[model samples]
Target: MTTDTLRASRTFSDWIPASWAYPETGATRDLRFDYMRGFVIPLLFATHFDFFSLLMFVGWERIGIVSTAEIFVILSGVVVGMVYGKKVKRDGLPATMPGLIQRSVDLYRISVVMILLVAAIRYVPWIDSTVITTFFDAPNNQTYQLYPPLDGSLSTLISKALLLQIGPHQFQVIGMYVVMFILITPLVFFMLSKQRVWLLLGISWVVYAIHYGAPFQSLRPTGAQFEYAFPIMAWQLIYVHGIVVGYYKQEVVAFFRTVWGKWLIVASVLLSLGFMFLTWNHPLPHIPQWITLNMIPAETFHYLNNEYFSKSKIGIGRLLNVVVLFISIYALLTLCWQPLNRALGWFFIPLGQASLYVFFIHVFLLLAIMNTPLPGYKDFWINTALHIGLLAVVWVMVKKEFLFRWIPH
Candidate 1:
């Protein structure tokens, strides 16, 4: 055979398609992500502890229309996009799947362990009813209960084991993350291969729209009712959106800097504030009765009207609030990150960096505090001390790498 023919016959090796490989890993570690996440951990703890505390009243949720849970979930998505998406972009599909699977497995293990730990404590005879009622108890619905009746116990355990039933106060949010990662894996790789993120986003939004109109709610072990806490189908849109932004961080940043981007940012802020005004107790003067609906009983109307702005469903108001807050923070950080970092970095950085460990430990701390005979909210000094103590312990844990080193993350 001729030399040219012989060369042609030889199969090419180590040739990766451009579509399959990225220019760089794009693995930039931004402290802002950690700081924001760290900031939310304490707020999440406080919100879960109770809704009457000073932190609850004047802090994360109170200052903004959206709850800290929105921030937490969105940040989780962005980080997942940055970390896992970068790995996929850099190394190609096959190389990234194993790590993603492993990470999901680890999260699942943590979720189950935490749920069981909380359940075990609830079973203790001396445990206070207040703690059980407040934290461990599931919402009063036929859908599911964390500590079910005696007859329902075995079924509840079975359902939880299968992840078909996740209690509200437990690690249901983490379980949703695990589910999203697993479900989105194939689509992510396919979309990356096609280089059509918009198509992926369109598909995601369709699901979100459908779910919003009529949610595909979670079922109880008995399959009798719907559970809406952090509804997965609807919330996955935010997660997927984060992944898209994280994967295309450069493009997103560039777009945001443009004139159109600035307008959108301003509009988002205005819309968010408007929605807040509509939902809050104080409505604007001179608004029509039909718009304000003064005809309905105020309390009943407030409850029903607020459903349009509900946190549990990630309603329109909450979604807008998060978007505006995120854009505002991003802009602020771009201009003043250095000074801001210097001012508040120490407080949130460590906790943010070791968020998983801090989050896991906070549950135990919450239970202990609730079980104590002290007045939880009546004594201002005691309440302040409890928060300070929890913060200090978590700070030390992160700094000392107590569970930070031990945890698989």
Candidate 2:
């Protein structure tokens, strides 16, 4: 080849690395966050729908004490912590606080709009009004129920406007999230600035303990017997701890490799298994009565109800189950085969990226399905198809950020 041709080829090669080269700048986006969020979104949808009792039969509720609700909350904390924590680290809290508050306000506004939309649906002639109104009556035993009083007094409207009365049923989680985000924005940043994260965490745990031990009425009124389903005082422990982890994710992961961290992981796994054994009903088929007797103590296994390990109260068993699951899942993701990881990431990451839109859309869809009395209740195949369609539709809608592209950073 001519000298000039050879020189040009060399220059172009230097400008662009070979296909095999791996860049040192790292990933532009962490697909793990999106994938995890995507994973939680379907589970959340299924829980809302009760998976037509399939989830119960599969032991998602019984043996697995932790619910997707907790995962969603913790993930929210992690995302907020990473995003706002970096901003605070870079620009200082003074500059970051306003944006944090603004984002919280945006979430609050979205929630209010959601509540109003659900309320208005009752007026549609074909749709069952009771479905919307009575769904949240006893949320522990129900889903998607919230209704405005017939009187609609000024006092009631005012309280609703102030969020002292959060909208019904599934909407309760939105309110808890609103409170958590607003409170954590300032609290997490301030704690970080003062290097008092541990102190903040300690206080959070104390509040959880007190709230769980002596449950109290919340300021918010939903007309349900309980003040709020989520009970923010206890759930905040998960939120705050998530923030610390997200803020110091690298450090935390490094610590997990240490002897103490490994031991802790082992303990967490064992505790989770013990809870499953105690709470589940014959999780392992055909086990000997003698073996069951030895594995599960009389005090632990004889209980009729597992509400002591319930999702509503954020029970101790539930908390430990999630901790172990979260850690184990994280470890598995890192250790999994590369091809499988890429495939899984490809499927879930987009849904996670557009999670906010997906969440809003799914709730509306589920509400319609539950209220309309759809025909697929008894058919396993139909239900499976419905779920697959739900995920597929959301995936397609969110793939290009169709409705969410305009959301401000």
Candidate 3:
């Protein structure tokens, strides 16, 4: 290592963002993950909006087997591990217990509030019944049962909400997180502290496997309706894996710099592209008939997507897709962090930093939009404008730190 060579290395390394060049040390927030979360926020809004004209290009589960929900969950787990894993390492598991408990309680509170909000909306005279009916009518959307029945069953609804068993379908992930924080996250932190990472993963895999035979459901108080969207037993695999990777982030990064790691990155890139090509025409909004590939027969595609890549079950195909997509995207961002950051970091980083605030507020925005005639119009330009306008409003709210003092972000 000559002095000139060392100088060049230092210069190149300095040019890269710290988040890309090194693992998070929990001393400072990692902007890269925040940016990814920020990026996912609008996609989430677009997907939920349903009739948005540009949904085919940006909707959930449209790109491949993956969705923004998966990204959010995995990134959340990674962050929990990075932050609390470090704490456990320094002060032991007991010291980090309060933070975990507080987080779980906060998530539970949010879930309850969201459930109440939806219930309140159902009773609002000005808000049209169409808002509730639209979701109720959709067969695929029935799983979460977004709207509670108005048949004078407030007691059941409130009881379920208090139990964290039911909520707005869109906010179901929050309820799932409430459970994960309470039951799973502490064990993850403990295992990481004990350096029993493989043992933790083995247990997670076993739970995920069991979910296949005995699928868990979040039944309502009456036990007739399964209101939970995410099956915790299955989805925990992704979250647990994220915690392990985040706990060993430095080691993982080092491995990726090795020859075997480079090979794995190349393989991931190829697989991701293949998945994208297969699903290029699978989005909600219709593409021109002439633009179709027809590589996989329509029947075959549907069967594979439903059986092997199902979102609720966190199916095998989705599992594979997320891993490859993460690897490919992580590598691309690492290589081009400086250029990409300069171009888009300003907008996304702030939103990502305040993602919880955005997530909470966006639900209200969507509800308000639904009550209007805007979604009924469904013009391409109108839909595009609506999506951009919604994102900008959220961005401004984030910039102003709207309710930051009161609301958890």
Candidate 4:
């Protein structure tokens, strides 16, 4: 091989990673892609994730909306990349494995810090363990199981400090969910480059479905691991899609303009909203009658009765909601969000770029004071103000020139 060929084979990735990772051609393009690493894309997601979070937290007796929101968006990011990769290859673009690796490394490093924070919540001194008090608990726990209570013991302090072994019996915790993404995202790049996207998606989805135990609905949460949960899987779909779209810029944009794309978007949205309403309220709404709203609690039938939806299976409503969400996000990129064509940018783009910092900080702050005798959970107005206030602080720290370097560099 020629000297030039040897270098290309080694440092960059093999199998044509992603065209989007590099500019279409020369120096300017490469720089532009790098700048993207800084902002705009992350914000689009941050808004959407938080939007759902607000919805999830709207009333009484629901999961922790903010935590669920954070995990979903992060997982969805992986899905976006997976889907985008396939489209890129079909459009005759180069592969993006090398770029994907670079991104994965960035994510891994972030996970490391989150792991440490989880440890510190159990042992760190004055930083107020409140930020990460819930780190020790299972993902979907109620009040009593929030976290490992701090014991002020030396052994517990040293043991819980690392991601690998928190204590004698502690499993690898903290951002292990993110660790799952780092492991699997590169595989997406590999499959997509080979035009085997449907195969990969099919496999992932089936695994996801079985993992959900939807077919058995009455199943209990036994050996089920956190990796296969649908809420997380739904997010993974987003990252896959982004990768596919980036790969097949021409094809995706074309599809968006087609009538089918428009119809897909509309139908998905209407159905998603309808499902949301039905899931929140039980009674299943007679399908023939039209959109129905029952103010009664969903638990009356689904959980309390142990009749339907009690199983871990992915119900029609939840699956459809996932589909609707997926198509809507994709539709924007295909239709108007032609990232390459536009020189214009949104103002929140900068803030969005440093999204991980915001995400980590926001989670830490919320959990820190979560269970203390603080004025949250019960005080709706105060909690709303606090959430908004936290957002502002993070925005300034992350976006403002003065403290930007110190935010999390």
Candidate 5:
């Protein structure tokens, strides 16, 4: 009954709730990034589930040119830089290569499995190929096809899947990750060690620039096969910059705390708003047009958007969108961490921590829902229920560590 004993008991009780009970991790681990990842996972799911009502809130291209994919890519780069970069410094590159190699192998293995799994579903007697085809087809007739026609020989299909030339279109991002980890990541670490950060960035920009003139046709091969959705050269720009920021996180944080850092944030906010206005009339479906500012000529708007804000190529506008928004958001989160973390952190943090697991498993859940005889996209309430249900299922799986031992996540 002593006051100290009572205080200790209260503290223990506070830790009982899931919000306060973060999983054990290294002291250096930043839960903020995990929370952001967790937040983006459901948005990604909602966007992927074609015609879901939730798209109104978090749909692709709904808010400016950026989407959850860009956030995920940048966060992935930051984490790699923070984790592997530190390891290189502590243990040297020799110790770091194995882990990077293993990560690439794991990504490749999972990607191949997903591709083969989807392709195998075609042969299942009960499952209709139409469902698979329908699922892959874009609602707006955009060529987002990831499923290849199995009309070819089985060996050829397998060969293409192994080569990462075709697969479940959802997993094309993973294939890109495999390639980056194998090739670009090590080079990033090497540059960081040698204090060649500018050189690394210069090289990344050069590669991204090459996309403008020649357009890196190899990644998006012209054929019947499923091409890579994210061209490696273009996307690497985000990931490389993420790595640089993550590796020097402390220095970066300190800089942001200074007067110059505050000015940068202010500039980022203005730039973000400017881009938002510029792309207000973007052509993507489901993007809510709250403000109608027809400032630019229609012809000029379309041409500029296609050339500068194109998502596939990580166009200049798109890159700028990612940068300004990332800075603005990161600053806001840092300023409001305590209350925001307490409010929504419980739900998202766990999901974010197990993001890869949720990501991989959701593919099956999405396939199941699409293949089943369910309510069509017309029923808004039903679609909303289904989307919420899908997120709930994955959240529970993550919290329970469902299949944690077996899955690469």
Candidate 6:
């Protein structure tokens, strides 16, 4: 009886809890939430994209805000199960290794397409921070610019093209995503289709605890922040959580409506609060140039670039942050407060469904506009506004245009 999407869209794909309420009247499709696998992804993307864009440009090249970009981006990718829950339906779980390998290749092609588009936009003026290529040194010399504009490196150029090289000053390391997803997804999907996922996850946590935290040293072209590759191990549990939660919506909904579930939510909240309080004052972990130690293979030019790792074991704070994010989200959803719940359901549905295209397109579109220099300061301002503005235009335009259809959710 509600006048929301269940009634608004004429033709719909069968999907979602909302659709369940109006089974005959509506259909849910790609964006439908699958409880567990579904919740955090949209939350993560909306959170990341909102924060990343609004952080404001401090210099010609860097973010004005704190550098949580690494964790945010990786979490965003893991949260992507809202989409994957739908994708795997159509694509089918590649049962055999051959099928999985083929699916990996296909996804690689998709990632490559996204990479090339972002790369082309590199020529655009204010978008990709090309000016940074001309300015700063990596080690902050308060006396001078620690990070400079490296517009002259062939290796850097090659790095961008490949999207996954262990060097400095490289950007848009999307290839790493392609690789991680391909290698990880098959097992992840297999786990999801089965009922005993908790057993596997417990083992995964132990495996992670013992190993080097996902070898996150590979993030950011070994040293440059530009090639910021997200860490898979850091958020692997989260991604698995996405799949687990989504695949068993009915059980999750029932659990949420239970007394014990309510307690779990409360416990999660307490855990989150405690974790944040303790970790807030902790310092960022500084990584010695792990690349040059030749404990790892690397570029000859790969000198030690100081990065603050957030894993407690490796001294990176991310381990704490991830725990905070996981617990807080779990508690929030389990509580089922109406208005807040409704808001997350609505926004997260769009954000989660549209995330892949949203992210890839955002980078591409912004770069296209910013990479090209405009006439004056006013014109430059307009270009920046356009960066935010054209998203609406692209969304509307994507409807009739098949090629651009990929732009919309």
The true-versus-predicted C-alpha distance at residue 73 of model 5, in Å, is 1.1
- How do the residues 74-133 of candidate 3 rate in per-residue lDDT, one tens digit apiece? 988877777887788788999889988988888777767877877777777888644433
Question: Lowest summed-lDDT stretch of 10 residues in model 2?
Answer: 17-26
- lDDT of residue 359 for candidate 6: 48
Poorly placed runs, candidate 6 (over 4 Å): 1-103, 117-163, 166-174, 191-199, 211-229, 267-351, 369-402, 405-409
Model 2, runs deviating above 4 Å = 1-29, 53-59, 136-145, 150-155, 158-164, 216-227, 269-307, 371-373, 405-409
| Higher-scoring candidate on TM-score, 4 or 6 | 4
lDDT of 4 by residue, 332-376 (tens): 332233353354334334544554555555555555445455443
- On lDDT, the stronger of 1 and 6 is 1
Per-residue lDDT value at 95 in model 3? 86
Winner on TM-score between 3 and 5 is 3
**Candidate 1 structure quality by residue, lDDT tens digits, 315-356:** 775777787877766555544455667787798888888777
* Highest TM-score against the true fold, candidate: 3
Superposed model 4: Cα runs more than 4 Å off: 1-99, 124-131, 135-177, 214-242, 279-293, 296-316, 329-348, 367-377, 401-409
True-vs-predicted CA distance for residue 168, candidate 5, Å: 1.0
TM per candidate comes to 0.79, 0.79, 0.88, 0.59, 0.85, 0.53
- Show model 1 residue runs off by greater than 4 Å: 1-27, 129-144, 150-159, 164-170, 215-227, 269-307, 405-409
| Candidate 3 off by > 4 Å | 1-28, 129-134, 137-148, 151-154, 215-227, 283-292
Q: Which stretches of candidate 5 lie over 4 Å from their true place?
A: 1-26, 129-151, 215-227, 278-280, 283-301, 375-377
RMSD of each: 11.5, 8.4, 4.1, 11.2, 6.4, 11.3
User: What is the per-residue lDDT of model 5 for residues 1-409, given as tens digits with 9 covering 90 to 100?
Assistant: 3454333223333333323333323346788888888888777876777654664455555556787778888998999999998899899988999999989888878878877887888778776644333334444565544556657788877887888766665655666767777778999998889999999999999977887667446544323133345777778899999999999987886686566876888899899888777766554444334433667766888898877887778878888888998887676555555567889888888988877777788778877887766646457678788888888898888888889987777
Candidate 6 at residue 310, lDDT? 37
Tens digits of per-residue lDDT for model 6, 95-207: 34455576467656655455444444446654554422222333453222212224646555546445433221222333444555665666766665554578867855764
From the highest TM-score down, the ranking of the candidates is 3, 5, 2, 1, 4, 6
Question: Model 6 misses residue 260 by how many Å?
Answer: 2.6
The global Cα lDDT (0 to 1) of model 6 is 0.41
